[model samples]
Target: MISLPEASLLALFLETLFYGVFFTCYWLTLGILLKKYGIQRDLLLPVATLLLCIATAHLIIDFVRALEAFVLNVDTIGADAYYSNLASPLGLAKTALYVTQPTVADSVLVWRCYVLNNRSLLVGIPGCIVLLANGAIGYYIVWCLSRTVAGTSIYTTIPGLITTFYILTMLISIVCTTHDDQDMTALISWRIWRSRRSISGGSADLLPVMIVIVEGGAIYATSVLALLLAFLTGSNGEYPAMDIGPPVVGIVFCLIILQVHFCVGNNPQPHSPSKSFTNLFGEQGEQNVGYGIEQMIEETDRSV
Candidate 1:
């Protein structure tokens, strides 16, 4: 018989796992869009924002359905519970945050697309329309989230590794000259290419640790390798965050499918990103040991 707290913890764990898979798919989609279609950076940001907002909404709804299990007693769940839960000033604030998420994403898209991207006649005239509109809504949600729901499941939402990375990056960004996707890529490329004969030079030992940190150690080495594919291409910097979940999950799922073959050691291995260099630049590309650490690319010639 599992205790109630144990059950709750189990639920939380499952929720986290499911969300991890969820995020992974989005990340893979985003990666494909970026790689092949060359999604506009400004466009991509709002789409990310929209996906997050939608995910947040789904979370809130599920929380409502699960109130009895996670919050007040199971039998006590009722109209009173529903009404009372939102009665707290804090609860109300959180509720506001939840409601406004979609609006914020929608409004931002409108502003960026219809206003800036379109070079709307409504924008350049400088009426402060978009500024006032965005500020009002954005700040409203910030206040709501800040006030609501007693901080909620933030710990589960962002894994320790990613949360820590964001915190450190934000702190450094406050003062240091910021490096964008390009600058980081150049550094990574030079390190990996060390004349191309060897594809193992830029091993930030800490990076492989991130795989275990954000994701549990259940996945196979193949999945981990696929998760590392972008890094092999020196394009890891192009991604904003881990971007591992979906690909890792896919890798794991495939591995599960290929288990018999793997056990027998008879199946062909899946394509390796190590081959991407070879794919892009051909045979000579594989031999690209041209430079080492000092070659930070100020800009990626290709679009991000």
Candidate 2:
């Protein structure tokens, strides 16, 4: 039975904490990408930067809204009244940021799936359609919110649309993560089978699986699923979940890029020129397969 203002306060606190973590991860990931691939050659650097900027903007907006509610307007409108105004300019701006952040994150996940699946139209097309639907549904929710009167409960106004949007978000995450994991697992298994003689001991046996899970956006998917469940159950917990989402998105993006960079650096291919991480996603390409196998074998040997 937490009130809207109480929920908003909790959400801001949680978001601030997570944003700090996101900032740290962002810097670390940026440094690694720049050092390994440089700014000009890698698409990931730009994507990571974009996610970071979006998350930062979202955090700033939340802080400003909170300040206006609890501090600036405390003697006049009061925190509860301020927060209950669904169509407030700050609230609308925050909603817009909320919508934009995940769309960007989901787009990147879909692109990763497409690339990892060797540019398969089957994967890319469905993902794009889902992404578009998710984006449209999100902005539609924002529009509905913008039309609500002050003190209107969001659940009353657009509960179905919010639920649908969360469901779509979860779907995109699960679908893209599944595709990435399958493609990565297939590539790793193929490499291990090809270089069976070179791999010995179980030292590196789990590394590939771990890498696949991390790179495939398992963390993001899990977070979104938790949020969806909370929202569906009519819990105030959804406040914190919704607020932390942007930072989580940024964190996942950084982790994927950083994991790939680390894996490549640790697994050197002496027989050929170093392969770009982007190239490793093309499991169907012969050159990619050759490079991937060599790197896996090298990593296995190092582990042994």
The TM-score leader among the candidates is 2
190-218: candidate 1 lDDT, tens digit per residue: 33333232334442233322222222223
What Cα-based lDDT does every candidate model obtain?
Answer: 0.32, 0.64
lDDT measured at residue 33 in model 2 versus the true structure, 0 to 100: 57
What is the model-wide C-alpha lDDT for candidate 1? 0.32
| Residue-level error in angstroms, candidate 2, position 128 | 0.3
Model 1: how far is 226 from its true place, Å? Answer: 44
For model 2, the superposed segments whose C-alpha errors exceed 4 Å read: 37-42, 178-207, 214-216, 264-304
Tens-place lDDT digits, model 2, residues 194-247: 442243332334444445555554666777777888777777777788888888
